[model samples]
Target chain A: MDFWSNFLINLVQGLTTTLQILVISIPLSIITGFILGFARVYGNKIIFYISTGISTTFRGLPLIVTLLILFFGLADLKIYLSPFWASILGFTLCGGSYISEYVKGAIQSIEQGQAEAARALGMNKLQEIIYIILPQTLIRALPGVSNEIIYMIQYSSLSFVIGVKEIFSVAKTFNSLYFRSIEIFTTVAFVYLLLIAIATLVFKIIENKLKIT
Target chain B: MISDTILNVVDLHKKYGDSIALDGVSFRVRKGETKVIIGPNGSGKTTLLKCLNLLVKPDKGRIWLGNIEITDPRININKIRRKIGFVFQDFNLFHHLTVLNNVMIGLVKVRKLKKHQAYKKAVDALSTVGLDNTLYHKYPAQLSGGQKQRVAIARALAMDPVIMLYDEPTSSLDPQFVNEVLQVIRKLAKNGVTSIIVTHQIDFALEIADEIIVMHKGRIIESGRPTELLSNPQNILTKKILIRNFRTLR
Candidate 1:
C-alpha cells in the first residue's frame, strides 16, 4: 500500500510536467503547421521552395536527434535553452512538419470551384483562403492532425532524457530505486493510454462540432 | 465607346497550349441588355463570359466595363469583379455556410455592409430568386441542385453588381429543376438586370435575349435579333445549333 501511494504521488507530479509540455507544444505546433502548409499551397515560388525545404529537413531527421541538437549541440554553439524549452522547440518543429503535410493534402482536396466562386464574388486571395477555404480544410485535416498529436504525447516521454522528470523519466527513477520494474512501467503505460484515449475523444468532439451537415 | 454600352470587348483572344479558346471575339452590351451567347462545345462562349468578368485573362484583347479598360494591368481585378456577378453551372455554393450566410458573406466581406444590412440584402436577394425564408438556415448539401443554384444566384445578386454573368447555370440541374432557375434569370432580365448568358437552352435565350450571339470555332459566327437569326442564319453552324437545340425552331 505504501509503494502504491508513493508511486501514485510521483506519477501525478510527473504527469503535471508532461501536461505542461503538451499544453504549450500542441498549439505552437498547430500554428506552425498551418503557416507552412499555407505557404506550400498558395505562396509564391520562393516561399513554396523554402517551406518545402523546412518541412522535408525536419521530418527527415529523427526526433531524438533534433532534441539532442537543440539541447546539447546548440549549447556548444553558445545558444543555451532550458531542457523544457528545447523539448518544446524540437517537438513543435518536427511535429509541425508532419502536420503540414496533412494540411497540404487537405487543402488540395477542396474543390477548385470553391476558390473560383469566392474569387468571382470579389474576395481577394487572402480573404478567400481565410473565409472560404481554411474552415473546410481544417475539418478535413483534423484526423491526421489528431494522429500527430497522439504521437507527440507518446514522444513527450523523450524529454525525460534531457532531465525533465515527466512520467516515463519518473517511472525510470522509481524502478531504479525500488527495483519494481513491472509495477512502475505498467503504470507509465497506463498513463500514456489514458492520455491518448482522452485526446482521441477530444478530437472527435471537435470534428463532430465543426463537421459540415 | 457608345454612351449606353455597359461592356465592350475588342479583338479578344485566348489560347490554352495549342488549342484556341477565344480568337478575335468582339461585342458590345448596352446597359440593361440581356445578351445570350449560344454555341456548341469548345466554341468559347464560356471563355468569353469569363474574359468579360476577368476570371480568365485574355492573351490579346481589350475589354471595357463602362469607360474603364479592364484589360489594363493596372486595373484591380477584384474591384472590377465585385460589380460583375457570375453564376456558375455547378452552383459552387460554400458548403460550410448556411444558405443565408452564403449570400451574406460577399455583401459583408466585399461590400463592407454591416451584418444586419447584409442580412437584409441577402434575404431580399433570396426572395427575388424565389427561395423562401424556410431555406435560409439550411446548408448547401441539405438543399437540392435547384435550390443550391438559386442560392448561388442570390449570393451574386446580393452584391448589387452592375452586370450578371451566367455560365451554363442550369446545365447541371435535373430537367424538372431547370425551369425554376431559368425563371429566376428571366425575371431578373425583365427587371432590366444587364446580363450575358451562355446556355444550350436556346428557346429560353430567345425569350429573354435582346440580341443573340452565336459562336463557333472561337469566333462570332453570327449575331442578330432572335427573330432575324431564326429567319435568316448567316452561318450554317448557327442554323445547325438552332435546329439541334432550339425546340421551337425544330
Candidate 2:
C-alpha cells in the first residue's frame, strides 16, 4: 500500500478506539462525579469523609500515574485489567475527581432555600437532588465540565503508554517505520484538534439550550 | 388536641448559639382559620413557622399536625410536609422551572399525581392566585417579584395542603408589587384555606386574621382577635410593633 493510504487506514482504526474510550468514559466519569460531589456535600459524616477522601486521593495523583497503577501495578495483586479497561478506569477516577470539584462548588453556590423549598414540598432527599438540585448544578458546572472534556480528548493519547493503541500511538508507530516524524505527528495533532473543536461546539449548543434565561 | 385544630404547638423553644429564637412559643390554628403572627425580626415568628413543618427542628417542643406528632423522630416528616404548604419570604420559586412546572412539581413528585392531573391542578392553583395564562410558560427569572411569589403560592396550593404557612410572603417584593401578593393571600384567606402568616403588614393582618398573635424576644407576648388585640393590646411590645407597622405603612 502507498504511504498515505496505509497511514490513513491505520489512523482511522486508531480513531475508532479513541472514540470508544470517550463514549464510555465520559458518562462514567460524569456519574462518578455527581455521586462523589453530592456525597461530599450532603452525605452523612462517614459518607462525606469517605467520598472526600476518594476524590482527594484521585485528584492528587497524576493521570499517567493512575493509568500506570491500574494497568501494571495492580498485577502484583493478581487483579488483571485489559489495557482498554485500565485506561477507562484511570480516566474515570482522575477526570471524575476534577469534575466533582466543579460539581461540589456548583451545588454549594445554589441557595439553601432551593433545597428547603423542595423539602417543604415533600420531595425526599433523592428526589430533591434528582429533580431539582442536579439540573441546576449541571448548568452551573457545565463550563468546568466542558474544559475537562477537552482535556480528556487531549490526554486520552496518554493511554498509549498502557498499550492501548489509540491515535497518537498509531502515529508514533508510523513515525518509527517511515521516519516521517513531521507528517505523521502533525496529522495526529490535527485529528485531536478537530475532535476538540467538535466537542466545544457541541457543549456550546448545550450550554445555550440549558441557559436559565 | 381540639377536634377542629389543624396545628397545635406546645412549649416550642429554639436557640441559635444562645440567642433564643423561639422561647416557649405556643399557638394553635383551627381548621380554615387565618392566624396572623406579628413580630420584629429575630423574635422567632419565622422560627415558629419553620418548626411547624419541622424545617427547623425545635430545640425543645412538641408539634401536632392534625393528629400526628410530627416532631417525633420515628414519624415520617415528608408525609407531614405534604399536608402543609410553606411559602417563603423570598418566594423561593424554582428559578430554572417555568411557572407552570414550578407548581406542577410538588403535585407530581410529592402528591404522586398523574402528569395530566398535576398539570390541571397546577393551572387551577395558578388561576386561583390570579396569575395570567401568558406567564405560565415563563421562568421565575422572567417574572416580577409579585408574580414569583404568586407562583410560589400556587406551587404550595397545588398540593391541596391542609394548612399553608407564609413566612413574610410579600417582604421580598417591591413596594408596588406587595399589594398584588397581599391580594392573593387575601383571596386565599377568604376562600378559607387554613393559614398562619408572619408579616410586617399589620393592616393586612388585621384585615384577614381571625386572631392576631404578637411575639417579642422569642415569645408570644399576647394573642386575641385582631380587633381586640388592636383596641386593647395586653403587652407594651405589641403596641410598639403595631405602631411600627402603622408608621412604616404611613
Candidate 3:
C-alpha cells in the first residue's frame, strides 16, 4: 500500500512535467519551422544556404546525441541550462527540421497559377504569400504536421534522460523506491498510450471541423 | 469609335534553349477590339500572350500598352499585370477556396478593398458570368467544367483589368460546355473590353474577332480582317494548313 501510494505520486509528477514541456516546445517549434521552411523555398542564395544547412544538420543527428551534446558539452562551457530547457531545445530542433520539410513540400505542391493569379490581381510578393500562399499551404500540410506532433509527443519521453522529472523519470524513481519495476513501468507505458490516444482524438475533431479530406 | 491603338508589340523575341518560341512577333490591338490569333502547334501564339502579362519575359524588343513601354525589365511588373486579365486553357481556379473566396482574393489582397467590398464585387463578377447563385458557397470541385471556367472568368473580372487574355479557353471543355464559355467571352467582347485570344476554334474566332492573325513557325504570316484573311489566303503555308484543317467550314 505504501509502495502503491508512492507510485501514484511519482506518476502524477511525470505527467505534469510532460505537459509542461509540450506546452512550451510545440508552439516554438511550429513558428521556427514555418520561417525556416519559407526561407528554404523562396529565399535568395544566402538565406537558402543557411536554412538548408541548419535543417539538414538537425535532421541528420540522432536525438539522443543532440541531447547529450547540449547537456554535457554546454555545461562544461559554464553555459549551464536546466534539464527542462535542454530537453526543449533538443526537441524543438528536431521538430523544426521535420516540420520545415512538411511545409516546404506543401508550398511546392500548390499550382504555379495560384501565384500568377495573385500577381495578376496586383498582389506583390509579400501580399501574395500572406493572403494566398500560406493559407493554402497550411490546409494541405495539416495531415503531415499532425503526424509530426504525434511523433513529438511520443519522443518527448526522452526528456527523462537528462534528469528531467518527466513521465519516464517518475516511473524510474517509483521503481527504485518500491522495487516493483513491472507495475510502475507498465503504468508509465499506459499513461503514455493514453496521452497519445487523446492527442489523436483531438486531431480527429479538428480534421472534422476543418472538413479536411 | 474606340482608339486604334491600345497595345503594340514590335520585334519581340523569346527563346528556350535552342528553340525560338517567338521571332520578331509584332501586332497592334485597338481599344475594345477582340483580336484572335490562330496557328498550328509551336507557332508561338501562347508565347506572345504570356509575354504581354510578363509571365515569360521576352528576350528582345518591346511591348507597349498605349504609350507605356512594358518591356523594361526593372519596371514594377505587378502594376502592369494588375491591368490585364488572363484566362488559361485549364481554368486555374484555386481548388482550396470557394468560388466566392477565389474571386474575392484579388480584390481584397491586391486592390486593398475591404472584405465586404471585395465580397460585393466578387458577387457582381459571378453574376456577370451567370454563376452567382449556385456556386458562391461551393469549392471548384463541386462545379462542372463550364461552371469552373466561368468562375475563372469571374476571378479575372473582379480585378477590373483594362484588357483580358484568353489562351484556348474553350479547348479544355466538353463539347456541350464549350458554347457556354464562348458565350461569356462573346458577352465580354460586346461590352468593349480589349481582348486577345489564342484559339483553334476557327468558326468562333471568325464570328467574334475584329481582326485575325495567322501564324506559322513563330511569324505572323497573314494578318487582316477575319473575313478577308479567311476568304483569301496570301501565304502558301496559311493556304495549305487552312485548306487541310478548315476546308469543310469554308
Q: Write the residue-wise lDDT of candidate 3 on B1-250 in tens digits.
A: 2257988898999999999999999888888999999999899998888899888889998988777788887778888887889898888887778889989988877778999999999999999998958668898878889998999998888888888999899989999999889999999999998999999888888889999888877789898887777679898876775667677676
Better of 1 and 2 by lDDT: 1
Prediction 1 TM-score vs. true: 0.98
Between 1 and 3, whose DockQ is larger? 1
Q: Scored by CA lDDT, what does every candidate get?
A: 0.93, 0.93, 0.86
Interface RMSD, all models, one decimal each?
Answer: 0.6, 0.7, 2.0
Local accuracy of candidate 3 as per-residue lDDT tens digits, A1-213 = 677786788678789989999888887788778888999999999999998988898889988788878898799999898999999998898888889999999999999988877776778999889877897788777788778888889889888788899988888777777778888888888988888899888877877666622
TM-score leader: 1
Candidate 1 residue A104 C-alpha distance from true site, Å: 0.6
Sort all candidates by lDDT, best to worst.
1, 2, 3
Q: What DockQ does each prediction reach against the true complex?
A: 0.84, 0.83, 0.61
Q: In candidate 3, how many Å is residue A201 off? A: 2.1
Provide the global lDDT of candidate 1 against the true structure.
0.93
Clashing pairs in 1: none
The B-chain TM-score of model 3 reads 0.95
Q: Indicate the worst ten consecutive residues by lDDT in candidate 3 chain A.
A: A204-213
Docking tier of model 3: it is medium
Candidate 2 at residue B122, lDDT? 96
